[model samples]
Target: MTMTVRDLRPDVRADAEGFSDTRRLALPYMLSTPESVVHTLTHAHPDAHFGQLIAEEEGEIVGTAQISVAHDSPEPGQGSANIYVRPDRTRRGAGSLLLRTAEERLAALGVRKLFAWVLDEPDNRAFAERRGFRASRSAYFLRLDLAAGMLPPRQDPPAGVELRTGADFADDPRPMFELDAVTSSDEPSDIAVEFTDYEAWLEETWQHPLLNLGLTSVAVVDGRPAAFSAAYTDGGTRYATAMTGTAREFRGRGLAKLAKNDSLHRARAAGYTEAFTGNDTGNGPMIAINKWFGYEVCATEVRYVRELG
Candidate 1:
């Protein structure tokens, strides 16, 4: 069967569905849906130059790729192209074709450095290595059976601290944004990011379709948002932690754990049966916290970098 690569048509619902379906099948631990796919494409920052591509084989989608420039990063000429082929459709050249097309598009936009996330499987690593990509860092995908696992019992906040839902900041989310910015900057990653644009955060993060504000928990210290666990639900049984972190000044106080535990409990009460999250391999603190909540490592992915001349 002959395979061809093309850009995803945002106006076409089937295209979004196919892209989301392929992603979910390829990376089950991560959450993806038609609505979330479309939302990402439409709300992406203009400077990001984001584009989604699909590989089709005789009218059937066999692979997908999301390519974009790291516009928000202070460093220039850095971009990313993440490609995934259906497990059953491997060896058909769909993954290669999609990646080639993505690289060409990003290169045309003056991107000199390209980054990708490849599953830690031998074949996946080999495929990327053959394309001049070098492994940089790794991260693990974790899963928890919310319906069957034993979650740590919720604990009361210590004196001078209060627990609240993300929804509590609906009228004014600037504090949430501030806390997210500080916490995210501290996350371990090969590519450093700074969330400085409040308006962009409002459009891309706060207003995201998958974000479940009611299920998200925040730890407030003296009326200030200090730590939080942002929740994302698929409108079904799957729940995922989008981001969990504590402000630098409040790191040792266990506020992050407190917030995440509350959010997990809320997710269970709301009927989500499964929970998922990811942590960089070097982030031992977060990994330990997830293990305490009964989350087990389900899969691992290696970050790869390639320099284009």
Candidate 2:
């Protein structure tokens, strides 16, 4: 069977299903649904010009790529293409074909540099480098078996600290957004991102399909949100911490850790068997916190960059 590549058609249900399926098989740690996929494509910032590309094997979708420009970044010409082939269907040149097409699009858009994330495996890394992509930053995907792992005992709210769910702030989530912006700025990453646009945050983040506001834990200090652990579930047993951080002034008090503990405990009580999250390899503080919670690195992914000539 001949392998072919083409743009994904969101108007067709099968295409969306195939695309979502390929992604789930390739990256189990992340969650994706057809609705969310379509939403992302249609509601994406105009400047992003995102492309949902799929690789077909005899008309059957076998691989997928999320190609988009870093439109919100202060600098231009930065684009990203995250490509993945189904775990069972490899070595058919799908990745190579997708990368070739994506690089062409980026170059045509005057993108001077391209970034891609390849799984941290011997074969995956070799493939990226073989295509002129040099390895850059890396992140660890951590997993916790909630059903069997012994979790920290949940405690009552400590003195002067109150616990609240993200839903409580539904009428006004600007505070949560403010806290997220502050913590995200301090996160380790190659691209410096600023989340200053509150309306954009509400549209893309607060309404995300996987966000489990009920399970999200926020630590309140004197009446203001000081720390939080955002939750995202796969509409099943898999639960992931989207982000966990403390306010700059509230650091060192262990409030972030406390919030995450509360979230995890509630997740386990809710019958989530698997929990997953990713942290930059250089984020020692977050790595230590995950270790303390008995999470282990299940996989890794490395960023690869290519200079567009």
Candidate 3:
């Protein structure tokens, strides 16, 4: 049976649902919903040229790929193609076909380097290696049972510190943006990124369908956002902390921990039963912080990179 690869249609609800289902089954730790999938498709930056692909066999969607350039990076011509096939449907030609199509699309766009994330399992790792991708950084996916887990006792912010939700800055989110810029710069990654475009950030991050401003906790110091725990939800019960960080000057004050803890508390109160987050394996402090909140490492993925001539 021949497998076919084609672009995903955001307007098609079935396509979005199938894409989301395949992603969730292939990567149980990451949060992917139909709405989030569509949001990404609609709001992708022009430079990124983001595209989603689905592999079909016998009219069934079995594999998916999210292809895009690293437009935010200062370096040009770098792209990423993250492909995943339904666990039960692997060993079929769907995965290979999807990846080939994605690579072709990216290469045509002048992409000189390609990156991918492969599960830290033998078959997944071998697949990437066979395709010329070399292992890079590794990250862990963590899960917390919000309903049953016991979080660290909430602590009062020290003097001059205040807690606010992301919604508080709805009228003027510049401070939050600045804080995000500073914190994101410190993130561990292969591609260095700078969040310099405020308008783009508003459209891509702040107004994203999955971002729950009401539950995203921010730590304020001297009337400015000093730390934040960005929250994302499925509009159902699952909650994920998309990013949690403190400004460089605010480090050691536990502001990030405070913000994340508050967000987790709010998430549980709102009936979100499961919480998820990811951290680079080298991010020891963050791993320790999540462990403090009863989060357990559920899965691991290794980043792989390939040079395209």
Candidate 4:
């Protein structure tokens, strides 16, 4: 069997479908679609130098990698390379070939520190350790069966607060962007990211193919967005929370929970049966809120770092 790694052709429908299928099979807890795969490649910031590679054996895609520099981060020389091989097609040298290609590409882009997420399995950890990558932080992929799970009863916002949907901000989404920027800066991660470019956010986030504006819920205080839960759907039975956060000044009031709960109820009503979300283990408050919503830790992944010369 001939194994080769090459850059994905965004215009090719087969390439996108193959890439998305491999990712869905390898990481079922996360959502992926052909349209999303194309959107990510075309809408990424130019400075990010984003590229996606696919490892093909004969005519079938066996592995895929998404590589990019942390252009929005204040820290330079930081990059990410997430590689995944079809579970049924591993051990055929696809993973190693894809990693080698990813590393070479990232190194040429001036990456000094590379980061990757490995599933918390013995074999996966061993593979990273063998490649000189050391584990740093861990995160959990939580799942809730919306079909049978009992969501908290809907509640009325406080006297000065009101519940709104992302669709309500269509005429002017600058407020949602502002709230997202403030909350994203506080998220726990090895790399600190700043969302300074509103246009970039609009292209890369707000306008993404999976973003479900009608299902997303926001908490508005005095006509300003204070907290929000961004929802994404596969347009099928699966739904996910892209992000749920509250403005700094509005913390400690359970606004985040309120927004997320409202979003979940809307998702269930829209016929989404499964809900998935991820959280860093260090984020105690968000973890507590997910647990309160009856979400269970379905899987865990550890972030690994490797220094490049």
Q: Top lDDT: which candidate number?
A: 4
The CA lDDT of each predicted structure is 0.94, 0.90, 0.93, 0.96
Rank ordering of all candidates by TM-score, starting from the highest: 4, 1, 3, 2
Residue-wise C-alpha lDDT for candidate 1, range 1-309, written one tens digit per residue: 889999889899999999999999999998999999999999999999999999999999989999999998889999999999989899899998998999889999999999999999999999999999999999999999999999999899999999999999999999999999988888998778999899999999999999999999999998999999999999899999999999999989899999999999989998999999999999999999999999999999999999987
User: Going through the candidates in order, what is the number of backbone clashes in each?
Assistant: 0, 0, 0, 0
Better of 3 and 4 by TM-score: 4
- Give the alpha carbon lDDT tens digit for every residue of 50-114 in model 4: 99999999999999999999999999999999999999998899988988898998999999999
lDDT of 2 by residue, 145-227 (tens): 99999988787878999999999999999999999999998898766777778877887788888799999999999989999
TM-score for all models, in order of appearance: 0.99, 0.96, 0.98, 0.99
TM-score of 1: 0.99
Show where candidate 3 strays beyond 4 Å.
none
Could you tell me the TM-score of candidate 4?
A: 0.99
Better model by TM-score, 2 or 3?
Answer: 3
Worst 10 residues of 4 by lDDT: 152-161
- Per-residue lDDT tens digits for candidate 3, residues 1-309, read 778999999999999999999999999887889988998988888888999999999889999999999988989989999999999999998878988898899999999999999999999999999999999999999999999999887889889999999999999989989989988988999888889999889888888988999999999999989999999998789999999999998899899999999999999999999999999999999999999999999999999999987
